[model samples]
Target: MTDSPLHVTVKLNAKLQPEHRHELFEDPLDALLESAELGQLTGGGTALTDEGEVDYGDIEIALTDPASLPGVIELLEQLGAPKGSLIQRAGEPDQPFGVTEGLALYLNGTDLPDEVYEQCDSNYVFEQIVERIEGVGEICSWWQGPTETALYLYGVSFETLRERIADLVATYPLCQGARVVKIA
Candidate 1:
């Protein structure tokens, strides 16, 4: 099966007061889309969710890769938006690692395959790892932290997954470093 597109939810807490919420921007949706990198804003009429979760507005976009998530979040943050955003598999996002800060991989069990907890500081690089080793065991659950992300996985062996992780670390940019830890 082909890989799923990234479905992202970006929430914005506008810097405006309630009375002036309508004046947050001339065209808030347009203002938001200007900063996007990989995906485009899908609809035309009213893309705003008006879900009341955000003080301002919320928009959803579809991206080709989860790796582009960091860029999307960065743009939203710059505009005082995306207080927090989540990405999921376009198809079955509600599944494990389906939603997360920047990106996540929720896995099963402890004592990973080879005592190897492959990780990198850059979400972009981590996205590469996800792309390379996806569709193994169950979906990966990830927690994107300030400095790094911890990815929990299952069903895959260390020798196999590690080789690909190592190869990605060696070949890609933004993933200058990686660590494999044994969680006892």
Candidate 2:
């Protein structure tokens, strides 16, 4: 991995405006900064447009290492951001890193209105498999739909991630009726 800075473009959740970022993105952004090493949120923090709509959703951050891109995306997802974001060398769009390297699994089982909230602890289930994920993977960095808060994951390989999380998905009460679909 190069020590040269790279730009990571994060897609924010348009459902929320800049005013809500303090509670939604600030904490995680702060945590991410600890690892990303002083990257700033530029271009995406502007106020809402005159129509009261989100004018922009992508925030570009400078990273000290290209390898930390995935970690950055993972942290953003944990805070409920939209997915499908990308990273590239500071000035080279054609040279974006890992565009094809992203693989994901959506745990559409947790936080279901039908499931008991206490039992649907998405983070709890993650705790059970964090150690088992020997392969590269993470919760959604690029996801679809707004029907519900999607509990998705991104990984280097879908089969590996599915295998790693299968046990938890099969046995967890929260995972009942949950479909683990592979994201394109």
Candidate 3:
């Protein structure tokens, strides 16, 4: 496995928005590979659900390391994959973490103005989350939809991440009824 070119599909957390997921995971993933000398990130074309039918979040890196698999999983736990997360492209390994096994906080975007607001301001939901989750977690991805903004966080312990952001979820106007779902 070490000598041969192997396919590693590191299935991500399920709660993250399935669109453009590469942006959420690519930086850390590339750094890990480069620092560890694992392999290069050969870009993949547009991803699809069924034979290029839909817009799929696609990111590609190369490797086939049986020995390093456990270590890989450990490092990637920040992305919410505490268990084994990779699958062989050639189907060697049978199971991979589900695309749905992840966590996210959905904050209402209704009243939030487009203007920039202070960190703690209810209008600036992203900054508020970033400030509170200093070490607990990092927002990996976010989706600003018609109704709400889904903030996908990256962290080791789900409990800690929740604790760090609990106050905002409870008291803040925009986050008053925020939903934090941990699918893992």
Best by the TM-score measure: 3
Candidate with better lDDT, 1 vs 3: 3
Model 3 alpha-carbon drift over 4 Å, by segment: 1-4, 14-38, 44-58, 64-84, 95-102, 110-123
Local accuracy of candidate 1 as per-residue lDDT tens digits, 12-125: 332222323233322453455455545555431122224322123334666656786666655544433322323333464432111211222322223334234354234565
Q: What is the TM-score of candidate 1?
A: 0.30
Provide the lowest-lDDT 10-residue window in model 2: 94-103
Instruction: Name the TM-score of candidate 2.
Output: 0.42
**Residue-level lDDT tens digits of model 2 in 49-107:** 55443333555576666676667766666654433434433465632222312233345
Q: Tell me how many residue pairs clash in candidate 2.
A: 9
Best-to-worst ranking by lDDT: 3, 2, 1
Task: Kindly report the root-mean-square deviation of model 2 from the true structure over all alpha carbons.
Answer: 9.2
Candidate 3 lDDT: 0.58
Query: Candidate 2: which pairs clash?
Result: 83-141, 83-142, 84-141, 84-142, 103-155, 137-155, 138-154, 139-153, 140-152
Model 3 lDDT tens row, 1-184: 5677555665443334444445545667778878888765676444333422222243466765656656655555554452334444564755554322335787755655544223445436678878987765677665666676677765656677788888878776667557797735
What is the clash tally of candidate 3?
A: 4
For model 3 the local lDDT of residue 54 reads 24
TM-score, every prediction: 0.30, 0.42, 0.61
lDDT of 2: 0.53
